[model samples]
Every structure is written in structure tokens, then in C-alpha cells.
Target: GLPPLAGFFGKLHLFWCGWQAVLYFLVSIGLLTSLFSIYYYLKIIKLLMTGRNQEITPHIRNYRKSPLRSINSIELSMIIYVIASTILGISMNSIIAIAQDTLF
Candidate 1:
């Protein structure tokens, strides 16, 4: 996920914990994999946003002016999810406190 997203916070906490525990190897591996996954995530986002798939046959591409038609509901939900994740990430300490209270 992006810097402002929930996944970034989750990974950050995980890495911090690993560092605190002195698990340097695991933390390094996790960080490396997370960085690698960003490329794939961005590629997927680009495809969704652009509605174009270069892998598709030219015949099929020509058949539809837009290869991937936009769905209003999906777009709306995506927007909502992104907003929620950003808000949650910013307020992560509150969430952690609540979770700790409930768990303990």
C-alpha cells in the first residue's frame, strides 16, 4: 500500500516490533518484500485507472473503445475504502488503544 494507507502503517508497526525484538533478518526481508510488492500494486492501479490492457489482442481492444468499462459502484467503493484507510492510518494510535482495551 501507499504511504498514507493502512497497509503502510501495519507494516511499519510490524517492522518496528521486529526491530525492538532484535529480529533484524526478518525485518529486512519483510521490508524488501513490501518494497517489491509496491511495483505490482502500482501496476494494478494503473491498469484500473487507465482502463487499458496492452496484453489484450488488438481485435478485442478495437472492439471496445475502452477495454475496461468503469463501474460506478466499484469506483465509489474504492474511493470510500481509500478514504477510510487514510483516516484509520492517521488515527492508528486510537485504534490500537481501543483494541488493547478490548483484548485486555
Candidate 2:
């Protein structure tokens, strides 16, 4: 429902047309590509679902804290922006609406 969202819609339209279109081959290719994409999407999902049991290393640095022992304002704002954009992008038709709302 992300990158191949439009492709799925196209597939539906093609099927609705009873497969009598001149570009039936294109539809077939699209279907095959969509099928292949499922493998990749599921692979990513599987990787995310399986968590690592490794413990955090003490040597790892924490950049979230500023040198003055306070939380960094800029870093916090950027994190919020990234989170908001991701949520909005998934909820809306496309990011164009978000961009327009942000810009204008």
C-alpha cells in the first residue's frame, strides 16, 4: 500500500476491463512485478518483526544529550518533524497534500 499502491489500483482497473485492453502484456508485467514486490515487502516486515537479543554496549555514545546536560532542541524538533511526516504520509493520498499545507 505504499510504493505499489498505484500499481494495485491499475491491476484492479485492468481486471475490471475484462483483460481486453491492448496493453494486456503491460498488465501482466505489472502483476508479476507486484507479486515480486510482495517478497521484498514481506522480507522487510520479517526483519523488523524479529528483534535482536543483543544488549546495548556501554561504549555507545548518546548524542541526544547536549554538552550542557540538557536535551538538544534542534534534534528534538527534527525527530518530531520526521515522525509527523511519516504519519501524515501514510494517512493521506500522497505527500503532496502535506507539502502544500506546510508550504502554503
Among these predicted structures, which one has the highest lDDT? 1
What lDDT would each prediction earn against the true structure?
0.86, 0.69
lDDT of 1 at 72: 57
- Per-residue lDDT, model 1, residue 20, is 100
lDDT by residue (30-94, candidate 2, tens digit) is: 77887898888877677567854233344432335568855578777999999998897687766
Candidate 1 global Cα RMSD: 5.9
lDDT of 1 by residue, 1-104 (tens): 58998779999999999999999999999989988999889887898899888955687566633346665555678999999989988999999999999999
| Per-candidate RMSD, Å | 5.9, 8.5
- Looking at candidate 1, the ten consecutive residues that score lowest on lDDT are 64-73
Total backbone collisions for each predicted model:
0, 0
How big is the positional error of residue 61 in model 2, measured in Å on the Cα after superposition? 15
The model with the greatest TM-score is: 1
Q: Which stretches of candidate 2 lie over 4 Å from their true place?
A: 2-11, 14-18, 52-104
Q: Give the clash count for model 2.
A: 0
